[model samples]
Each structure stands twice: as structure tokens, then as C-alpha cells.
Target: MANSTAKKNILNKIKQALDTPVPLPFELNNEAVNVFQPAKEELEIIFAEAFTKLQGKFIFCADENELHAQLQLLISSKEWMKIFCNEDQWNVLYSNTLNLESCDAAITGCEYLVARTGTIVMSAAQQSGRTVSVYAPIHICIAFTNQLVYDIKDALQFFKEKYIAIPSLITFASGPSRTADIEKTLVTGVHGPKEVYLFLVDKTA
Candidate 1:
């Protein structure tokens, strides 16, 4: 009887605490970050390092020929019957002869590559809509060296300057989807693509 009474008292105390409202401990600041300024080479190195840590595959292509060669080799080695790509990049995948619906993988380009966080910034304007990017089993992103930005702020600034109106959808894809909600057991591809590959092309070459 005494223990039951103590339990009731604890429940009542918790209810009283919940009923009371408390102000936040600290004020929120809206100031943007402006300290870091990374060079092109430094950005590439940092992006590669951070992306690798997230289990993303990174490949560098020195020129168009190398890019085609690497892509062809990957397709052949994987024995993929068909490869999907955005219509805008049809010239890049001259050898690809399959339709998007029948493809096992999708290749698309991104708006900007964030070096600080190792994220690829994408928008709905791109041919490969949200469906193709996340639905496919394999995702391959083609990005140029010039697209690399020091951080998210720089990327956002680029968007602000380039687009008159913001896109309906924007994606900051850091890596493949991973879930650890159930029993804390890590599972990849739970909500999105199983694998992601980044082809960093040297447009200058």
C-alpha cells in the first residue's frame, strides 16, 4: 500500500511538471558562418575524405574519354543489362542503349558538391527526378571539379545566384540511406538506394 502511494505521488509530480511550460535555456541565432574558405584542391581532398567515411564510392575521371571508359567498364563488370541516365546527359552515355524504365542504375548530375559536409546538392529541375535518384538500386552521380564548393553556405549562395526561383524540391544527399532505429542494428538501403557512386570529372581537361 505504501509503495503504491509513492508511485502515485511520482506520477502526479511528473504530470505537474509536464503541465508547466518552460522557456528555452538559450536563444537561437540566425547568423551565418563565414570563416572557412577552402581552395579547390583542399575542397576535393576534404570532400573525398568525408564521403569515404560515409561509405560512398568516389571515382575520378581526368577527361571525357576516361569518364566514358570508366562508366563502360563499370557497367560491363556489373553485368547490368541496361543503365538509366537523365536525358540531358544522353551525350555523355552514348553507349547506353536502354530506356530508363528497364535500367538497374541511374546516372545524373548534381547542382553543387558541398566539401565541408560531403553532400551533393540536387534539385527537381534535373531530369532525374526524386523517383529515379532514390528508387533505383544503384545511383551514380556525375559531378565536375568546378562544381565543388567549400561548404553548404557556398552551395546555397550559388543556388541563390543561379536560380530566379527556388526549385520545388532540393536534395542534399550525403550518402546512401541507413537506418539504426530497430535494436540499433545498422541497415543500409532501408529508405533509398543501396549503393551510391560519385564520378568526379575534370571538366578543365
Candidate 2:
């Protein structure tokens, strides 16, 4: 009888402990506010580090001359006889010398560069569209430093603020398409571009 009473007491104590109210780890609104606010320099550093770790190339150019030089060097190194680019972007960034069909690579402009996850946000309306960025062997994106945002949420908010009408689709490309299907061995470029490069121009300069 005594042992039965002790067991009941123990059970009640545990129940009471569990029922006690504990403080939340953090206030939800404050935490979200903190996450949404990020310094520009901090975003730049984190994005570069994360993107590099993903095997994506990050190129920073101070001015238009340097940007052109980098692009020329990359084109020569890849031996890209012809390049595919959106007509609008080509008009703004290049002379119309390369045809669309014969191009070995496709370069486009991105809507936003996400810092936290090292992602580039692309809209269907952009020059690259959906097919060129994914179908081409190499995908090169040009973005101004002003386009960098702290996180995906911030990127979305930026788009909302900037555009009254959103595009039909938005793609967040983090790195080259990769799969580890057989024996857990990873292979890249199976579904999409084999290489991804981001040319970030410092607009402040």
C-alpha cells in the first residue's frame, strides 16, 4: 500500500513539472526583425564565402573597365566561339556579334543576389529566362552590388517593393546542378549548367 502511494506521488510530481510554463527561447517578432536587418558589408562577405564554398565562382569588379576585362578573360579562357545572351542584356553589355543558336555559354542579369544562402534570384522576364540559364553548359550572371540582399525573405520583399507585377516564375540558383545518385558519389551538371559564375560589380565605384 505504501509503495503504491509513493508511485502515485512520483507520477504527480512529474506531471506538475511538465505542466509548468517555461519561457520561450526568444520573442518571434524581434528575432525576425534581427534576421531581416543585415549590413551591406556583412552581406557581401558572407555571400562570397558561402558561394565560394559551393564551388561557384565569384568575381568582383570595381568599375566598367575591370568588368569588361574580366569578361574578356573568361571568354578567352573558355574558348567560347559564340555566346548566347538575352537581346536586351547584349545591347546593354556587349556588341551584337554572337548569334543565339551557336553560343556555347549564356550570360544573363539577375534580379537579386541572396547573401545568407549564396543564391541568385532570377525571374522569367529577365534576359536569361528559364531555359537559357538551365540548358546552357555554363551560366554566368552579372549583378550590381546594390542587388545584394540579406536573405531569401529580404529578396522577396525587395521584389515586392520594386515591381508592381511579379514575373510568372522566380528561380533561386545556389550552385551548379548536382546529384549524388549512385553509391552516394556526387556528380554536377547533370540537370543544369556545369559551371556557375557571378560577376558582382560594385556600383558604388
Question: Which prediction has the highest lDDT against the true structure?
Answer: 2
TM-score of each: 0.78, 0.77
Query: For residues 71-132, could you state the per-residue lDDT of candidate 2 as single tens digits?
Result: 98998888876677764845456533355545677888889998988998999877666787
- Candidate 1 pairs with clashing backbones: none
Residue 20 Cα positional deviation in candidate 1, in Å, after optimal superposition? 25
State the C-alpha lDDT per candidate: 0.81, 0.82
Task: Give per-residue CA lDDT, model 1, range 14-48, as digits (tens).
Answer: 99988996777987665664666545476778889
**Which residue runs of candidate 2 sit more than 4 Å off their true CA positions?**
1-41, 91-102
TM-score of 1: 0.78
Instruction: Tell me each candidate's RMSD, in Å, in order.
Output: 6.7, 6.7
Model 2 score (lDDT): 0.82
